[model samples]
Target chain A: MIKAEGLTKRFDDNLAVDGLTLNVERGEVFAFLGPNGAGKTTTVRLLAALIAPTDGRAWVNGYQIGEDNINVRRSVGILTEAPGLYERLDAVQNLTLFAKLCEVDDVAGQVEKYLRLLGLWERRAEPVGGFSKGMKQKLAIARALLHEPPLLFLDEPTAALDPEAARTVRDFIGEIKEAGRTIFLCTHNLDEADRLADRIGVIKQKLIQVDSPANLRHSLYGRRVVIHLASVTEPVRTAVSSLPFVEEMQQMDNALVISLDNPEEQNPILVERIVAAGGAIQFVNELRHSLEDIYFALIEEEDRETQA
Target chain B: MNGAKIGAIVEKEIADARKNRMIILSMALIPTLLVAMVLGTTFVMLNVESVDEASLDEDELSMIPAELSGLNPSHALLILLNDQFMFYFLLIPMMLPVYIAAYSIIGEKETKSLEPLLATPVSTSELLVAKSLAATIPAVVLTWLSFIVLIIGGYLIMPEPVFLAMIRPVWIVSMVLLSPLLALLSVFSGVIISSRMNDPRAAQQVTGIFVVPIIALSLVVLAGKIFLSVWMVFLAATIALAVDCVVLYFAVKLFQRETILTRWT
Candidate 1:
């Protein structure tokens, strides 16, 4: 779990994170989304106690970030943007060293456990310098999880990996979440966030919006339902648009996309009218707003507010 | 301050150094080569032309230190040259540590390995102390090893009494006391400089320049301007220990976790 109140970090004249307050509950996957230079990495560093917040306070895993930093560091795992591994050291040696530093009991067993879990056990003896970027990143994740900390702070967890490797990392994150560990993942990948995050926080030097993926999309653009018909007949269009619950409707190809004032209360009446009007309905489904749309809209709104 | 964490870091460095060809070569070969070159070249110079005991002039006799004045010209020259070479031994403690400690921290940064290590439960003091110990221990060991080799080699070529006298209280005190203190100073200075600079080469170059005065002191001893006796060795060790304390204090002060993670690179 993570809690921050008015957490601000300033480097001389530049404000990296400004008066940002947030809470991530236990066993929740909270994805932090922002563009470059948007204070995402800085916020992660502050929460991890790698750097102290200039003003305000934060608690990670129930320990105050600045005051109980040692305990806080011990309780959380961090995967930096760069894997930051000892390239000259092999995977097993790397994990073993971290395990000892963390004072993990049975360090060898812990190292082997994480290395095998991350699929680096086969290459344990090979120097990490020879590993592919994806392999190195996976090894880094393994290093973070070696001590099995309750909380994880991942910065750009899949930044430079190929699509397949990225998917593997995403699946691993999902697995971590399913295991009931708190994750504060900062990433530029909105689609991955959409799929894996229980809640996503869109940030720009401050917290812009924080909500579940479905709730954010619904708040940005009200529920949209699409009726796929055999043909875009005038009868279907007029019948659907004339309904009391229909706020707006647009015809795209043979589908009629309608935004309703309240789809839950009014969808049955709309569907009955389409059937009674002799319109051949192929399928009907509610259209959900993509995370990409909400991401751009939120970021653009923040930029516009800044300019004003 | 946890010893286990510090031990883990030092152990990791040793493992890394074993795998690093440059570090292994510098640690093992440089000291060997330096001792061989200094002693071999000295042996050839002293044994080039043996001189009669009575033929030496008083001016040349007076040039030798008072401790070795009673010996024959050849014996006296061997002792004087051996003593002059003691300064070169100082170079081992002073120079080798600069290279090791300079590379240790900045090399980690360049490789992008410092962030995660710092992110661990190890405190800054623990990290810096482990690093200093890692650089200092091997350098001190090599210094002692080279001194042993030099002593054995000197005994083989030079007169036994003269060689025996050279390894007296002064040399023993210098090797045991002054050498480690000087190595500590070099390592701590290197850690400080390496932490502030982004490039390892630049850090090493600067540390090399800062250690020039210690090297210059060795040159002064070689020139017979500064006579190094057991008492003088103790004095030098005392002064170096004081300086080491000061350098360590400032190193700890300058070594900020936030600045290192954000400002350097």
Candidate 2:
């Protein structure tokens, strides 16, 4: 639903978004991960046609970013980092105003649907000035979805919300994903992105890496499997290490961690050999790397590379 | 330009204005002050005979102008004061909208609401035009209403002949034509300033400088340096119309999405 090629935005001498190129497929939840000042918000603006790219080109829902700007703007929903709501106006009024701007067929009906969906129907009449941050953010999300655009660009979807409110927003995002909509999510919350994103794009000034969560872990640190042992004996350890698929092995406490290539296919062979060697197995699972691990490693690596 | 979007923006701005105590106070109090000034001047004109005419000579009365010299002292004073006070009507167009247009965009930026509003499909042209109308409509309406009160209050106290002369073509054109144009000038000028400045107070203070020219013209007229004729009113209207077009063009140009988002700070 969204494509960008060499998308660069330069404000005088400072480059905000530098040569970002990526394609997000339909019904895919693509999460963009980066450090502070990594051009996430600027990229969202360029894609949404809120601001034109300085040198490169981008397309949203089949319209070029700067060429058919109105169509592009109409085709996407954007929830900015700040809620950016009208505080003096009530919740319903804010949604209704955006609905009118987006040219929704039935403003009130569209507003009612999203407000109820985001659990804001009860406080629609109260002024937004007194609303909590999470309430305001939900209302902002509802405002973005009021017109029912096919693509959504959310910048830091859950920046400052409490845990419960963040979970509510995350669940709502999952619901949106289930409805077969394309979501371009920019978030600093690694756990939320790890759970919600179908594919994650780790970026800093450029596209560092893009892959599925599992694929990213595999590509970063090959295949690794963790096995819980009833008891570890020198014979079982020596036998497991002798297996050809076992490229490396380490014993931590009562568990054995072994690194292998293609563990999904070779794991049965390795487990059978361990069981045949009188090794009583209690638990066996793949050693999955969390997104936080990959995120910091990649960022630190990039910083070192930049300094070099 | 979608009328629905423009209308919605205008409607929201008007609603906000109604709820804003500072804006409401300025709108209400400015007109009341104008009314008080008008009425106080009218009462003094009506009671000019009670003052000592012996102390003041005919030269002071001759300052009223050769054409208006045929009238009695009270009548001449009413016509003189009425003609010079027409300049005060210019303040309405320039003053009221400054309070409003000064806060139009900068207020939203400060409140962090401009981003999402800009993210919508509404273009810059539609947004600026809607804001211009939002500031201009109320100002022109309140100005005309206050002018009507000033006129009627003058007529109630002054004699019939003086009232008839005061409500001539010049003041009519000034109110109907010149006032609205001046109000547009004020609004667009405020929009231009607010587009560049972050602080609403800074925008308003800079926009308040525009009133200097109108005040200067008022002072010149009061000093008997020149009398305002219908032709002069038309000339001022034509000049104001051209200036409004230029200022509005710059307002639209300077209010770029990137500039507003990135450079205003």
User: Which candidate achieves the best DockQ against the true structure?
Assistant: 1
Q: After superposition, how far is residue A103 of candidate 2 from its true place, in Å?
A: 1.4
Worst window of 10 by summed lDDT in candidate 1 chain B? B218-227
Candidate 2 colliding pairs: none
Per-residue accuracy of model 2 over A161-223 as CA lDDT, tens digit each: 999889889998999999999999999999999999999998887878889988888888887
lDDT by residue (B1-265, candidate 2, tens digit) is 8899999999988887777888889888988887798778777756555534455587775566666656665566666676667777778888888788877677787787888988999998898889989999999999889888877786687678777776889888988999889989989888888877788778778888778888888777666667779999899899999998998889778888877777653
TM-score of chain B of each: 0.91, 0.93
Give me candidate 2's interface root-mean-square deviation: 0.8
User: Can you give the TM-score per candidate against the true fold?
Assistant: 0.96, 0.96
Error of 2 at B249 (Å): 2.5
Candidate 2 stretches with Cα past 4 Å from truth are B48-55
Interface RMS deviation of candidate 1: 0.8
DockQ, all models? 0.86, 0.83
Ten contiguous residues minimizing lDDT sum, candidate 2 chain B: B47-56
Model 1 lDDT per residue over B1-265, tens place: 8998888889988788778887777777768887887668767766577776566677665666666657676776666666766767777888777766777788887887888988899899898899988888888998998888888887787567667767888889888998899888888888788877877667767777656776677666655565677788888888999999999998888777787789754
lDDT tens per residue, model 1, A73-99: 999999999998887889988998899
Candidate 2, CAPRI quality class derived from DockQ: high
Error of 1 at B80 (Å): 1.8
